[model samples]
Target: MPRHNSTEKRAARLVQEITGEPYTVCLNAVRARSLAPLAARGVPRNVLDEVEDELEDAYGLILDLPAGAAPGPVAFREPPVAGGRAVVRGEEP
Candidate 1:
């Protein structure tokens, strides 16, 4: 669950403005950004790394999944090249 804090809200909003992604995704991105700074501040590295890895899999880094997979398990890897148009929902056909 994301915190309902003003700073996080603002950062999520900025992410949405720049990326045009859904608010949920933007919020996830914002939350994923905290681990590095917190680790830098002397927080427990192992726990933060684990949680950060999960969060990144959820939103930040794309992983190559098998065809028809529901993005279940994750390994940090480059996404395979594929061609498809990202249709904007509000755009005319």
Candidate 2:
């Protein structure tokens, strides 16, 4: 079951009343508000691109992929090193 705080429950109720959408959809919409400010800022193209990438990761947004392409299993990756190279699991530095 999805956990919702009191504030989220109230917002979802209001949204459902206004739009007549299902509770789950309304709740998801309310949850998406976290990204609203960033989107409304009209950020520059380059900056918006970067921000969108980070927000997508943070918010678990679905990434656009090529048609008919299957997504691979999630893998853990090591943090970037000083020179900005990423280290995958089981690989030496």
Candidate 3:
């Protein structure tokens, strides 16, 4: 069991508050997004490496984001037309 420092604990808590995920999962996501910036700011390489290890350990616990949260490419499908009437899949006639 890895012991988290005060800064790490606070980071995990803040991420959980924003993302509604467990601390470990939030930590992994936050670390993944912040590693490069943190390294650029002169944070030690060894510390960053530890964070990477944590991310790898917690990878499986990360939750799937809601559909609207991370939208993928929009695919445009041809409208269905029958008997001179156009039908939209989820709209009322």
Predicted candidate 2 versus true structure: per-residue lDDT over 1-93, tens digit per residue: 657676666765554443333567656645665323322332223332333454355444432332443322333345455534333353224
What C-alpha lDDT do the candidate models reach, one value each?
Answer: 0.41, 0.43, 0.42
Q: Which pairs, if any, clash in model 2?
A: none
* Candidate 3, residue 7: lDDT: 54
Off by over 4 Å in 3: 1-3, 31-93
Off by over 4 Å in 2: 34-93
Question: All candidates: CA RMSD in angstroms?
Answer: 14.6, 15.4, 18.2
Where is model 2 poorest over a 10-residue stretch in terms of lDDT? Answer: 35-44
Q: Sorted on TM-score, highest at the top, how do the candidates line up?
A: 1, 2, 3
lDDT of 3 by residue, 1-93 (tens): 665556556666554443233466646546445544333333333434444555446542222332333322222223333422212133223
Clashing pairs in 3: none
Worst 10 residues of 1 by lDDT: 71-80
Return the TM-score for each candidate structure. Answer: 0.34, 0.34, 0.31
Q: Number of clashing residue pairs in every model?
A: 0, 0, 0
